[model samples]
Target: MSRIGKKPVELPSGVTATVSGQTIEVKGPKGARSFTATDDVTIAVEENAVKVTPRGTSKRARQQWGMSRSMVENLVIGVTEGFKKELEITGVGYRANMQGNTLKLALGYSHDVDFEVPAGVTVTAPKQTEIVVEGTDQQLVGQVAANIREWRKPEPYKGKGIRYKGEYIFRKEGKKK
Candidate 1:
C-alpha cells in the first residue's frame, strides 16, 4: 500500500473539487486546475476530500496510486496557494529586469537576452539580481525558472551565473600554481 495514497487530500474552506470519470478538477481562490489519472488508479471526491485508490494489486497500479494522489494534492495547492520560484543572479554586470511581458537578462553576453514571458505565468524582477516566477501551475512555474537559469547556469569555478535562490554551487579548487 502507498502511504501517501492512503491519506485523502482535504479541501480547505472556499475550495471545491469534482471528479469526472478519470479526471479530477479543483477550484480555489487562485484558479482551477484538473488532472486526468491513468486507468491504474481511481479518483473520487468525497466528504470534502479527494481520494485515490489503486485498481488492483499490481506494481503499476501501486505506483499510480501514490502519483495520482500527489497530483491531486498539487492541484489543490495550486488552485489555493499557487506556486513560486525565485532566481538569483551572481556575477558582475549580470542582472535581470522585466519590461512588460519580456524579461531582459544581462548575463555577461555582448547583447541582452530577451525572454518572452509565456501565457499563464508571471515573471517579475524585484531587484536587478533577483527574478521571481509565479503561477498556479507548479510545473510551468518551475520550467520557466529553469529556462531562465539555463541562460547562465552557475559555474563551479567562479560561481558566476543564474541559479535558484539559496542554491549552493559546489566550489572546485582552482589552479594550484
Candidate 2:
C-alpha cells in the first residue's frame, strides 16, 4: 500500500472539485486546473475531499495509485496557493530585467537574451541577480525556471552562472600552477 495514496486531499474553503469520468477538476481562489488519470486508478470526491484508489493489485495500478493521488493534491494546491520558482544569477556583469512580457538576461554573452514569457505564467526580476517565476501550474513554473537556468548553468570552477536559489555547486580544484 502507498502511504501517500492512502490519504485523501482535503478541499479548503472557497475551493470546489468535480469529477467527470477519469478526469478531476479543481477550482479555487487562484485558478482552475484538471487532471485525467489512467484506468489503473479510480477517483472520487467524498466528504469535501478527493480520494484515489487502485483498481487491482498489479504493479501499474499500485504505481498509479500514489501518482494519481499526488496529482490530485497538486491540482488542489495549484488552484489555491499556486507554485513559484526562484533563480539567482551568480556571475560578473550578469543580470536580469523584465521588459514587458520579455525577460532580458545578461549572462556575459555579447548580446542580451530576450526570453519571451509564455502565457499562464509570470516572470519577475525583483533584483538584477534574481528572477522569480510564478504560476498556478507547478510544472510550468519549474520548466520556465529551468529554461532560464539553462542559458547559463553554474560552472564547477567559479560557479558563475544562473542557478536555482539555495542550490549548491560542487567545486573542483584549480589546475596546478
Candidate 3:
C-alpha cells in the first residue's frame, strides 16, 4: 500500500474536480487544469475529494499509484493557488528586464539575451536582478525558470550567474599561489 496514495485530495472551498475516464479536471478561483493518468492507475472524484488507486499489484502499478495521486493533487493546487519560481541574477552588469512577453537579459555579454516567454507562463522582472515566473501549471513554471537559469548558471568559483532564489552555490578555493 502506498502511504501518500492512501489519502484523498481534499477539494478546497470554491474548487471543484471532475473525473472523465482517465482524465481528471480541476477548476478553482485561479483557473482550470487537467491531467490524464496511465492505465496502471484508476482515478475518481468521490465526495469533495479526488482519489487514486492502482489496478493491480504490479511494480508499475504501484509506481503509478503514488505518482497519479500526486499529479491529481498538483492539478487542484495549480488551479487554486498556482505556482511560482523566482530567479536571482548575480555578478556585475548582469541584469534582467521584461518587455511584454520577451525577457531581456544582460549577463556580462556584449549582446543581450532575449528569451521569449511561452504561452500560459508569465515572466516578470520586478528588479534588475530578480526574475519571477508564474503560471497555473507547476511543470511549466518550473521548466521556464530552469530554461532561464540555463543561460547563465551560477558558477562555484565566482558564483556569477543566474540562480534560483535561496539556492546556495558550493564555493571552491581557487589559485594555489
TM-score of each: 0.98, 0.98, 0.97
lDDT of 3 by residue, 1-99 (tens): 799999999999999988888988888998899899999999988888888999999999999999999998898889888999999999999999998
- Report, for all candidates in order, the number of backbone clashes: 0, 0, 0
Best by lDDT: 2
- Superposed model 1: Cα runs more than 4 Å off: none
Give me the runs in candidate 3 sitting further than 4 Å from their true place: none
Candidate 1 per-residue lDDT, tens place, 1-177, comes to 899999999999999998889988898999899999999998988898888999999999999999999999999999888899999999999999999989999999899999999998999999999999999999999999999999999999999999998898999989996
How far is 56's C-alpha from truth in model 1 (Å)?
0.8
**Model 1: lDDT to the true structure:** 0.93
Please, what are the lDDT tens digits per residue for candidate 2 over residues 63-160?
99999999999899899899999999999999999999999999999999999999999999999999999999988999999899999999999999
All models, RMSD in angstroms: 0.8, 0.8, 0.8
